[model samples]
Structure formats: C-alpha cells, structure tokens
Target: MTQQPLEPGQAPAEHPDAVPLYGPRYRENPAEIFSELRRTHGPVVPVLLEGDVFAWLVIGYRELHELMGDPQLFARDSRIWNQWPNIPPDWPLMTFVAYQPSILFGEGPDHQRRVDAMSGALSEVDQFELRARCEEVADALIDGFAGSGEAELMTQYVYSIPVMTVAWMMGISTTEIDGVARDAVAALDGGEGAPAAYGRLAATMQNLLAAKRAEPGPDVTSRMLAHPVALTDEELVPDLLLVALGGQEPTALWIGNTLHLMLTDDRFSLTLSGGRQSVGQALNEVLWENAPVQAGLGRWATRDTQLGGRHIQAGDALLLGLAGANADPYVRPTSGPPANNAHLSFAHGSHGCPHPAPEIAEVIARTAVEVLLDRIPDVILAVPAEELTWRPSFQLRGLLSLPVKFSPVPATRS
Candidate 1:
C-alpha cells in the first residue's frame, strides 16, 4: 500500500476560527479548550482532526441534541462521508470511519436488526449473576496488589474489571480472558499494532460465533446466536466485536474518572473514600464533567441543511461533541446533580449505545469503584492530581495511570 497526502488543504490556516482538535493544549485541558471554542466559534465549529481531517464538532447542547436525535438529517453511515476520497489508506482514523457490516456503521433496517440483536442479547445478561462475577473478578484483582501497600490501580484493578466481566458475559473462560482484554485495548488504542490487534479480535469473535452456533449457552454470544431476527456469522461477528471491545475502555475510564473525583474533591471525598456513600453522585458528576468517551466517530449529513446557524452540506461528517454538550450551560447549567442523566455520554438516537449497554457499563464501573474503595479504604493519589498525565487522544479522555498508596492488607484468598 502507498501513502497519500495528509491535509484537507487543512483549513485551520484558512478558517482562522477552525480549531485544530489535536495537540497538548487540547489533550491537557479539553474543558478550557471547549470553553474557548464555545466562546469564540460558537457551538458548531469547524475543526481539524489529526492529519488535517476536516469535520464539524457540534458542541452546543441543543445543537448536539438535535444532531444526535434526528438521524434522518444526520445519518449514521460513514460511507456517505464526503471526505473519504481525500483520506489516505493508512489514515489513523480509518478504523473509526471505515464502513463495516457491524452495528457501529449500520443504518435503517440493517441498523435496527443489529441493534435489536445486540440489545436483546445484552438484556439476557442476568444482573445479579453479573454482579457476583464482577465481585469475584474485583476481589481477585485487589488481592493481587493488596499486600503491596502501593499500586497503580488503573492497570491492575480499574482496567481489569470490565473486560473480565464482559468476558464472562460472552462465555469466554477465565484462561482466555486476559488475551481478550489485552487485544481489545491494543486494537482500540489506535497504535501501529492496532490493525494486527483488530485482526486477532475479529478472529476470536468468529471462533466464538462458530462455537455458539453448534452449542449455545447462557451467554451473550449464545443469546445473540439465538436472537429472533437472526444474523449470519458475518453480521453477528462485528456486533460481537462491538460488545467485547466496547465494554472495556470507556467503563474503565469512567471508574477511573469517578475515583479521581472522589479522591480530589473534598465535597465527595470524605463520604466516597469511606464506603458506598456519595458513590452514585460521584459517578454521575464524572459523567457530566469528565466523560470517558469524550467524542464519538460521528454522523454524516444526509443532505444540505442548516445547523447552529451554519450551512452543513450533504456528506459532511459531524463529530458528536458529547463532552462539550454535557458541559453546555444552556442544557445543563448546574452540573453537580444529574438532571436525569441528560448528558450525552452514551450518545443518543438510532446509533447510540443501545439499551442495557450503558446500564451494564454503569454496573461494572460502580462495582469496580465500590469494591476498590471497600478493599483499600486508605487509598490516596500517589502523586498530586495536577501532576497526573492523560493519554493523548481527542476521542477518549482517561488518565494514563492512577497510582495510589494504601496500607498493606492480608490477602483474603490464601
């Protein structure tokens, strides 16, 4: 394969207010950047993703709401994107924008079938059983570092909870759980190894689908295999990939963000660090202020239309500005209390993370946080909060590490 040009004639230079959506400034302080963008460029601002990929970033609360809710105007399919012609074969965002048979890019009847299959399969996940599994995984993870007195919770605990539970839900045995988690992280992290990692995960899902076909069970894979609408192995595999990979990173970050908040903010610290008190509020607050998945790959315009006082041409891609919308004063002026989880953290409309998925994620996130705090009540930030660093990605907002210190504890097992 040959490399091609990188810039969209990169309009940031041409469109002065067109904010380049990458760089240390954006990564280090996205809120400040969003605030500045709202003040200077208003809600629907012209932006450049890395490689000078031009797209719309819909930051206004109502505007984002309308964009997501009204998919008729803004379609979910990326194949309609006008910018595809200019995108290089090796483009960094190819995985995000690439059209797939998966639910992520599906539209109309196809989208509905996939969503129904996914939602129905997810609905079969018995919450109580899932909780027990989570507690078991959480306990085992905590036991690993319990005697250390000091540990990096992100890698050891926060990250492990979701993947393992999701693995259990998918009927993956404990032996193969680590590889599933490892591959999911690498594939989504969008590095040089991402393509190969993605291939490995896809292959794993195919094998699972085959097994479920011959002998189904009480698992997400088997349930999807048994969905009424019926999906071919080709159709089912991508959605399975979605469930497997999707459940991990964001939920892990959600737990990490909530913990970071509980530790740093005195308002919730005393209660949150102690036990279950204020845990729910802390989680909700983090959803509004520090959404794990800050931005979604987004929607393409079906036809030319007006949005946020700007003309949007047909096929123009619009990145769903979830974090920005959550912060929008017009929609959620006061953030401390969730106005019924009105935040677009899970996105909305046809293409949003379907029912039971967000609930499931919240369960995993909340359980992870509560169990960790219960096990290590004395945990505190190993370094000053300001000294903590974040991974450099405009799409996901998460701490690179969550190093903490606590008193050494006797292993509950052995």
Candidate 2:
C-alpha cells in the first residue's frame, strides 16, 4: 500500500502519545525510555523533535541496518526533504538537517567525491603518531589536575584531549586551539547563539584552509589541498569542518561515557577490579549500551514505503536511533557480554564515518582512560553518580561534569 505525500502547506499528522526525544526526563536516563518505546511501538516509532516537528525514529537494530544500507531508498541529502522550505530558520534541528556542501550531507556521486577526498586526506594521518600524541595530551591534562586531587573529569581530561589532538592534526596552532574548541562546542550544542557560533567556526576553518594552502604541512588540511579531487576553498572548508568536528565531539563523548560506566556500574567495576573484562572490552560495552551519538542524521525517503508496519511517504524524514537500536532486545541479549562493533553507534553503509576507524577511536579513548586510571588508581566519584547531569542535546549523549576525587599526586609532566 502507498501513502500519499502530505500536500504542501498541510501539517503532518501528530502521534498523540509520541515521545519527545529531548527533555530532562529523556536526558536523565534514555535507556529506560528507549526500552519502553521498543516494547510499545515495535521498531519504527513516531517522535517529536524540538519545534514539535514529527519524524520516524528507527529503534530496531535490523530496521536501522536495512535503512542505512539502502541509501538509494533512504537518501542522506537534506535538500530533497519536501518540507524543508516550511521549517523555520530557527528550528532547533536546522543546524543538523540544513543543506551543507560537505560529505556528510551529500548523496550519490557528489557524496562519493566528498568521501573520497576526505578518506584520502584522513589516510595520510600516521595512526601510531596520532596515538602517541593522544597519550601525551592525556598525560599532560591529567598532570594539570593531579595535584588538586578533585577535578571534573569531563572538563579537565576527557574534553581537552580530543580537541587538542584534532587541532594538532589540522595544524592549528596552540594559540587558536582554545577558540576553535569553544566554537565547536557551541556549534554542536545548538543552543542560543548557535548561528553565531557556527559562523565563527566556519571563519576559523576558512583561515586554517588559507594558511594550509600558503604553506602546506603534513596535516590533514594540507593533504586535502594536495588531493586529486582538487576541492576549491568553498568545498574544502566545510569538509574540513566536518572532519574536525566529527573527529573530536564523538570521541570525547565516548571517553566520558566509558569512564562513567567504569565508575558507576558494578559490571564494569568488576572488570576494572581484576575480572575478565579488559578496558577494551569495557569500552565495547559502552558502545553497545550508551553510544555517544544517540541518533543519526535524517534520511529522506525516496519513495512511498512501509517500515516496521508504519506507512512512510516519499520525502518523509527518518532518524536512525543508534542508542535505541543498540538496546533492542532482539539482537542483544540482556545478560550476556556485548559483542564488539555489533551496534550501529558509528552507523553503516555509504554514510558511515569514514575517518578515524572505530579501532583508532578505541585506542584514543582507552589510552586516555588508562593513563588517568594509572596515575590516580583510587579515583572515585566525588558525589553520587545519580547526581551527575547530562547535556541536553538531541544529537549527543554526554555528561556535563564528572567530578572525581583522588589522592593528590605531583604533576606527571613538566
């Protein structure tokens, strides 16, 4: 059966009991709500994003996998979204869904061009050197707070390592790293002043691109400039921005979430307490249970279809719920150890994250956490874990702060 596209100027129908994806309730413990959603609505559930916009949320592992793999049927280019013109400029989701000339938002041959250029540039990065730099940064960050004995891990350690590492990869100078980090955070949060924040971030990338063109280095930007794809500055800038943002934010969140699991959950704590699970195994558990990216970008339907028993009209938007799909009871057993890379946290198919393979991300995260643990073996949460607050963003799942206490030790790095 075919479902007709909603006529222009007509409002999409609302699901009276549809869950809102962002709010204090959802942020506090999304897993619970996700489980309830799966039980009540099966795989494809209707959801309300900010601005009361309606979209289909794919929660079943198999359903999300099929949708991502069949990109021809479910396109990534937001330009084809039939109701984009009607969405307000200030709509909360505009920052994510609006058309951009980057690999992330393109489709078909255009997507191939952008991804090829991006993958080529990323391939030039020396993984061994990258890991060493990450370790050095992690040690230095830990050194800064080692003496204080009480620090917020998110701000002091987890967040800084990824940004500084990414800055170095892009050949951004020490002086400019702070500014770029601030703007990147603002842009990702999509809070008030997000537009201005995005402008500043773009301006920073533009300047970086110019400098790389003038004096090319071994950085990713220089490699991109030298690639045969020959992306012009306009094309080069957004892709650079995508790589930097994509590399930093999710990795930071992964580290923080993994640390949180080790500190709070007994199963992970047992692993840390000399049980069977290694840090890498614990990290995989986090990937399956509390993925950094809760939901993926919207994929527009190319033709009328039925998904998980719900009618989906052409041009309708669907969001792949990574965290929710990972929690789907069908694929993941409630009692067993998590299988490595079994979840859609990084997504799959043509739109999967091309750079920073999952293995590299794991190394970066594991190294950071291991360094902190080695330096402060007795580190524990300063307050009850339940009291910790989470960032209230639809796209990200991370803590705002993770205050920890440990015996003061001298700075590890001079």
Candidate 3:
C-alpha cells in the first residue's frame, strides 16, 4: 500500500509496509530494523503494536524532540484519546499506555503538581549516598558469586543492585524488596496476569504509603507524603510505582548493557581498562545505541495533525522512538564520540523523567560497574554476544541473561 494522506478522525490504513513493533523480530536487533524503517519510510513510520493496533513510531531526532516538547498538541493524558474506549484491556501495551493516576499519565497543572511532589522528594536524595549504597549492594551481590567464578550478571548483580538500592532508598524493608521488585517487573512487562502484578505492586505501595503516613521516615516515600501538596493514597500509589520502576529498571539495564559492551566490544574493553574512552563514554554510547526504554510511552494527539509528513488523527497514539532517534542519520554524527550528552534516553520536554537526575543515574551505574571490575578485573563473557537474549517487551530493552566467567575469589564482604 502507498503512503496516502489520511483524514481527520480516520485511523491510518494498515499499509503492506506496516512494521510489527513487538515480537521476536523487534526484540532482537531492533536498531537495524528501526534504522531501515527510518531510511525507507521516513521518521514517522506507522507500526502494528499488536493485533489490529497501530500507531505512528517517531524515529527522527528533530521530529521526536518537537513532538515531545509540545504537550498541548501531543498529550500524555490517554483519557483524551478517542480510540481509548475501543482498545481492549488485554492489549499488550495497555500496561504502559492505559490511564493511571500517576504523574507520567497527567498533563498541564495536574502534571506539574505530581512533578512537584516527586521532584521535592527526590531533591533531598544525595547522589553520593546513593552511589555508595549501590556499591555496597554490588559488593554484596558479587560476594554471592565470588567463589563460583561463573555467574549471570543480570540476576546476580546488575538487576539486584538497582532494585535493592531503590527499595532501600524508598524505606522498604530488605525482607520485602525481592517481592516488590518481581511484581514491579511483571507489571512493567505487560503480559499474562499483568493486572494482578500491577495490583500487587499497588498494594505494596499502598502499604508503604500507610507506613510513611503513620511513621514518616527519611526515605522518598515519607518525603513525598510530607510534601506540601499532600498526595492522596490513590495518587501516591501510582507515583511511587512510577518512581520505583523508573529509578530501578532503566538503571539496571544501563549497568548490564554497559557491562555487556565492555565484555564484547574492544573499544569498551580498552575504555574500562584505562584506554582512550571512559566509563561515562561507554554509558552514553550504550544510551545512544541501546536505550533501556527503547521506545517511550505513547502520547495521544489532541487534534488532527501532520508530523513528519504523516497525518495523525485526534486520539491517535504517537510513540517516541528514543533509540531510533538517537541513531537517526540526520542528528547522529557519522564518526567520533558524542560531542555532548544530548541523547533523549531520559526523554525531553515537560513530561520527561523527573526524579534521580541523569548525572546521579550515571553515577550509580558507573560506580556499580567500577566496583565490580575492581573486584573481578578479568571477567569475560561465558556465552558469545549473539547468544545473549533480550527480554521480549515493546517498551523495555534488556537482556534476559548475561553470563560471564572470571577467576574465583573469596567473598570479601560480610
């Protein structure tokens, strides 16, 4: 089917070239496919997210930046979407795009109120303290596998560090951290029982909020409770869920992806081993190439519009192709290191990630990786890079497992 002009209130007709945004094809080697889509179909490619669901995937750097900044035109409030009523609850992407009372799903004044509550709470966090906690967690995790000399970093180290650290920061007891982390991951990767997983997460947050309400502590949850806005339990639960998942998942992926790059790419190896590139460089490179949230949550169009030469009807969804935009030829340099940290991995505009500054997140990731390398200086990938499998999800891009081998050492931490 040819690219024809679409009219207002009409869904973009499914073209023969409509790419499947999910499934194994996208889970593996998404960069190549996204690049081809941008090259062949321009920046805004119409894609089939799931059964009979279609949305425009914004791949161009300039286009995505513009779209993200214009909250009035492209809003995050799914309630305003005309097609929302028609979409089934079981649709795989609903876990992300479905209406929630969190800051992530709000716009305008309501969004600002949520943002203020989160920002005020997160502002009290000490990045140095957070990094120190991450190192301690990393050391503890490494101690678990120090003797074996063979371990899956994703499970043993990378994944656990962020979740545990974020939990600790949020004042969750060590006893409940694992369950919370598991439920949060399940909720984020929408699939069977996602609603139950989300329910469990909400229950966990509700408990945390109640605990904070009764006995306020120095943690983020308490701080948010203590904010001037005085968020209700309904509002607080979803915000806590957003903050916890946002704080942990992507940071974990960054650590894992950076470690993977250091093991597989010679440039990364040299950088980690005191070569020309730095750990920060490797981290930024990974952000550009493999953003943890490869595609951001959907934004609904408030009215009929044209973006990157494609007609978008009112209520049509537009997904910001973050990783694709980073790799776009027009904005991406053909050669050399990124001149500045301008990548949209954290997104842009008013609705971007509000808590845990990018610098702080980078510090947490870099500190964790550095501590691990300091302990096990000669770690190598046990399986080939190609053998590594990514978790199948439309929003998150992360490894299922990253096994590595190293010389055995005694546990140094108690």
Best by TM-score: 1
lDDT, model 2, position 14 = 48
- Using all chains and alpha carbons, the TM-scores for the candidates as numbered come to 0.95, 0.94, 0.94
Q: Compute the lDDT for candidate 3.
A: 0.82
Q: How many backbone clashes can be found in candidate 1?
A: 0
lDDT of 3 by residue, 1-414 (tens): 123334423445455567777777767888898878988999999886766566789989999999999999999888766655456777666777778888888888888998999888888988878888988888888999999989999988887888898898789988989997788778778777777888887888999888888998889999989899988899999999988888788888999988888888986675554532367777888898888888966798888889998887787788989988988878778795475778889999998878555666787788888888888877899988899998877678889999999999888865
Candidate 1 lDDT over 271-302, as tens digits, reads 75465877888888888889998887789998
What lDDT score goes with residue 180 in model 1?
84
Write down the lDDT of every candidate, Cα atoms only: 0.84, 0.82, 0.82
* CA deviation > 4 Å runs, candidate 3: 1-16, 271-277
- Deviating ranges (above 4 Å) for candidate 2: 1-11, 270-277
- lDDT score for residue 47 of model 2: 78
lDDT of 2 by residue, 355-405 (tens): 555666776788888888778877889999889999876678899999999
Q: In terms of TM-score, which candidate is stronger, 1 or 3?
A: 1
